[model samples]
Target chain A: MSVLLTPDQTAFLQGTLSMNVGAVGRDGWPCVCRAQGLVVARDRRSLTVLLSASRGRAVLESLDAGSAITLVASRPATHATLQLKAARAARVGVSAAHHAASARCVAAFGAELETLGYAAGLSATLAGVLPTDDLVALRFAPDIVFDQTPGPDAGRVLAHT
Target chain B: MNISLESLRPCLDGAIPAVVATASPDGTPNVAYASQVHYVDSEHVALSFQFFSKTRENVLAHPYAQVQVIEPKSFRHFRLKVHYLRTETSGPLFEYMKAQLAGIAARSGMAKVFALRGADVYRVLDIENVDPRLLPAPAPPDALLKLRRTFAHLGACDDLTRLADRALAALAHGFGIRHALLALLDETGGALYTLASLGYSASGVGAEVALGEGLIGVAAREAIPVRINYHTGDYTYHAALYVADPASPRIPLPVLADPHSQIAVPLTHGEYLVGVLYAESEENAFFSHADEDALVVYGRHLAALIVQLAALPDDAEPALAAPAPAPSGAPLAVRYFAHDHSVFVDNDYLIKGVAGSILWTLLNEHAASGRRDFCNRELRRDPRLPLPDFGDNLETRLILLARRLAERCPQIALEKTGRGRFRLELARPLQLNAG
Candidate 1:
């Protein structure tokens, strides 16, 4: 059965969490890249993950309709982690709204990194959040959510609302 | 341009957590932060599998993975396409990773949560620099040249004591190793005793480490080199395992209260455990894989020299010494315990075990006849002393006893008159007591 993200989980994923998006290739091997931000829909059933076009070109090219996708979001300081798996995902066209939302999220992440001993501009530098930066968005409705908080209880399935 | 994983070893230090991406057999992808990405070789790498997470399950189903590692200093990212090879639960690699995880876990305040279950080996199929921008990496020191020079200096030593001194000196000067120790293995007792040490406030000579106690002991027991780049309280041998017994005076093992990096290399000759060479630094990640490799080679040279020097027969005749005049000052009380053969001078601990027995025998003969000269052959044949077999390390025990006396109580000193011969020089008159 498909599962939807809980209110708390959706809010946490949209916050300053470090995100990594992965996609499987035709050869069954997987490719991954660091994502800048995640924007969850009002229904909390679908989300848009953003990545730098230049750094994530290989993963972007592999993303198609019905392509298997996984996005892991983790809080660096606490190592509180969660994995969202979508059996079908696709690359979506980028819009100015998506870019602006990603920019604000990246700024928040940079502030979060600052508290964790990273430099001020580190998040922007890592995410390539400049005005000239090219961003790609992959949208998927996760069907499974797993708690990956790094302990014996990790990999346990999270209940959906 | 082609890039080798060997050149990017600094990225594997766990300074920046690496991300591993794998897929399930049904084409579902899994991505997570890898606890550790250890460099096994140019073609192989190992990741710490602490828990059976989705990543582990996916990798078991689909063996291919993409690992993204970043050099912390430059923040340059490199992607490695790897294939799962196998997993090792126990062995040299497992122990190495386990020690590494302990340190990492302690640093992150997750010491109990993070335990290494196995070392999952992976074959790196390809490597890619995510960004084309490059930073100039500094050239590493020539370890081969340093090892060659150290071996050259070791080849010139004449005796076991001199050989130990020269090797420690070489480790300091040639390899820039500030703190180092060389210990000789006591096979019958299943322990290793410190023969020589440098860069410690105390020489810690005559100190003992059981065959399976700490880093040095573990290396000796496994006959492999073990290294850790961070301080780990898990292997606190002296503080946790050592118990002081009044029956036997314990020689405290010399240790840095908080060592950030340490490496112990076992000195072995085929199947025989010869000794262990150990060094530590206050800086994290100070010892590299190249340093470990050089030390392993250097340990071999040390083992061969020890065997060679021990087997050489004494070619010089025993020296004849005149009886010394008794001192006029107050006598110093020398007490001997026959239980563990511990010897104390002026009610202070000096040494114990075989060395202690040798000292008691020498002092007894001196009190009875004022004899100052001795030879290795006589000590081995003496029924009163419990000396090991002829091929065993009688010379090393004398060296340990000689060093302990030189450090603790300089009133009595042993000087080598020639090979296999030595003279006991006493500056004070002593009253011998056996309790």
Candidate 2:
């Protein structure tokens, strides 16, 4: 079943997945690279990450091998981090929910998003104008989600999701 | 010069005013004016006059006497007292009295008449009881207030080295010492390191002394101030480290050369002796009782500062928790980087080395917390020979090291990353294992 996330959940997923995605590396070793972009599925049950193939291929290979991995996603200013543990499934295409999540990230980070080439590259990739081979999507189905949020309201939002 | 009555009457046929005071059996004090008294020594006063004086009778009965000689114009007072032993009408005192009377008569233009009469002198013998109230009231609160200010100043200081220097300077200035040095106790409290010094050549500092070695050591061991006359034969345990010129003929070289006064005050935090403050002067009586009191006050404040400084935790080191175990069924890769020579174990150990071992030893010895940056800097500047590489061959070496570590510690998951970094992920949170 595809789960539709509310705006708060969408924001939460973007933050958590962003942190966790950076932790993933080839052969369980973190490599020197940056987070490209985070795209959440319309149902919010899945998140699509666009990263450098060169930098991310090793981590994807580790995930494909069924190695248990932990991704730490967090919002920098707020001490909110989500540790999502799961093996990677097959590659999937960007969905409407993914584009909406991307737009929200762009709006939240604004000019800062350009520094990571996330907003520009993600937009190009989704328009069908950019080549898809340049990007590889790992559909993360969270097995265990650990949410560290500051207050009761944030905890409820994470718990409900 | 207001001479006592006994001296005045014998010298000039002039009577001098004197006041005799005595404490009665019931503790009540009695004072009487006497027209006859004389100076026996700088410390003693004698009276020779008619026995009808109440003070004379009091002194005769009680045998305890206090006499004051007052220079009415200058307001200067000389006080003395003696307990009576016996009375004598003739002796050198009598001859001295005769000379004084003739002089008095000559000064008064009655020399012929006074010379014909001769001089009468009565000597009081034995001095059993004499009370001299030379010390003023002890202003304990005033001393305490100065001590409090000193402590507050020291407490506001954040730097240990600077604080120690300031304290030594204050001590030296307050006590008027020609030279002062403060030596901090080493880890075992068996030795001392000179932390600060004043009024000495550069060669006179950075000296170390063992326990029971010098005045400093004695003060530390006894936990009290040690006052010595360096020139006296009594103090032979002077530390060579403190001597500016050992071959010089004088031992303490006499304060500046006076060799008569020296003091070593132990800086203590509670029962622990942190260091000693040594002060010396060239004068025989440089350190009066007042100076000793001042030093004690200063020493107490210094001790408090040393204690407070010792209590402050070192924040330079990074807090390194033990490596956590990797998740279940995860492949472990470990790598050793030779450039930095740091061991990067899988997600677990960030950095470890012989430098770390040395730092650990120092921290433990000093009872200090290990700081990451400080440890790193120490390693970078380490004067000792470099440690051997973890393995001859990086790849095979790491694999063996990992298997060995795994066998010894079953809980920790050690994995080798293809990159220089290794991951040691925890199967469970680190806090659970803490129990």
Candidate 3:
């Protein structure tokens, strides 16, 4: 069975949400890195998120072909969280489309933080957005998704791809 | 592994929440936001396990997790590799985190949503700074030097009143803490009364807070330190319990309109809780873990000194003051209520409980005879006043009575003449009544 993200979930992933990527290394140790932006594919089953090359070096080193990967997208002010897990992932070079999407996402994230009472330029700096040349994208097809909101229904599965 | 958790203490302030990464036994990775990455020690940390999420499940299965914390001031990030130890459902650390989370929840208007279930203790396996570009952190004030000076000042005090004043003064001068108060617990009344304070327009010396009412009360009741780094109305003592009525005898607790940081540390002598020491700031996150530690040590020192000074033997003979002629004025009405032993001066609410009872007794003794001096032995043996048998804080009560009189009814005073004796000083004639 193939799990597809609902329209609302896809919109949420592509919206001005803070993203973080998690990957497990060969030693079974997991690493985390902040994501600048993400772009959902048309199929709604796969997505690619831009990670800063220097900041996300730990997670990038942990990434391997067919290794497990997880990305959590959260709306900061609301604490609305969604987690997507895939059994496989691959690190790829930044594309022109990824670069443009990264800029748009970072700007939108900064605006969202501004509305949440963060000082100007502080929100953007906290997001850790980097030049597109220093960003790497990880593409994966999420097979498991969880509504990770901070309440009783947090771990409930929304879909299983 | 090259990094130490001590240097990364700022990152655990919860000013910026941490993101936790965990991997299941089956190799599936999980990531989520942990609201608090509590720094337990140099090799340990704790996370609030409020919800049964994927991260919790993965940790239970695999035991290994990675946490990334950001220092709000510098925007610097650090990654900590930790191994899951055991979850503590109740303890000092759990209470500390629960108190902190309550403030966070209240600020976000999610008080009902977030509840701390357990403190998941973790052993730090390694720590690494993810960012190479770092801002130079400002050198913190010398906490050890401050504590040393504070103790030195407290060591010179010989009485509870002097001890309380010196303690507050030490906090102001040494720790740079401007807003602070020292309150002693009235065990029989299940309340705490403010004896001394600093940095407020009003001294609020006689203000009382019921047990479990606010940070100070809760700290005394639970015998644990309670600290909130942000302003939260949910725990505001004045709003929580104090409702001043014109007819009632009450002193409103001193409050900051909008305090961003507040902490209350329980002052205990061994197992007995003696009182609470509290401090606040208008600036957010002003009190850190090190400050809390210093305050705890300072509170214990102050409590021990108070007990030691209170136990000193009295002078061999009671020194009596020569009866001075009373001033020519209208008789001041002194009313005492038996229900709560509350005293009112000229129909104005003055004080209540043991202090009030002591005042009533002193006034009666003065009216019956021209006696001006009293001894602790007579008060301790007095059957009319309610005092504990084992650890009767009579000396402290006299001190409280003296301070309350100084604040409310300046015409009446209680002056310590010796270790166990005190003289009742009056500037005007008094008419005593029992209501």
Estimate, for each residue in B82-140, the C-alpha lDDT of model 2 and write its tens digit: 45655556544433333333333332233343321222222333221111222221232
The candidates' interface RMSDs, in order, read 2.1, 47.8, 1.5
Q: lDDT by residue for model 3 over B37-80, one digit each (tens)?
A: 88898999999989887788999999999999887655677899
lDDT by residue (A32-122, candidate 1, tens digit) is 9888768898888899888888888777766763458888998877888899987777778888888888788777766786676554566
Off by over 4 Å in 3: A1-7, A103-133, B107-109, B145-155, B187-190, B210-213, B236-250, B270-272
lDDT of 2 at B226: 61
Which rank order by lDDT, best down to worst?
3, 1, 2
Ranking by DockQ: 3, 1, 2
Lowest summed lDDT across 10 adjacent residues in model 3 chain B is found at: B237-246
Docking class of 2: incorrect
Native contacts present in each candidate (fraction): 0.77, 0.00, 0.80
Question: DockQ of each model against the real complex?
Answer: 0.59, 0.00, 0.66
Which residues of candidate 2, in runs, are more than 4 Å off? Answer: A1-161, B1-155, B229-237, B241-258, B316-435
In model 1, which runs have C-alpha deviations exceeding 4 angstroms?
Answer: A1-11, A96-132, B136-142, B145-155, B235-248, B320-323
What TM-scores result for chain A when each predicted structure is judged separately against the true chain A?
Answer: 0.87, 0.55, 0.90
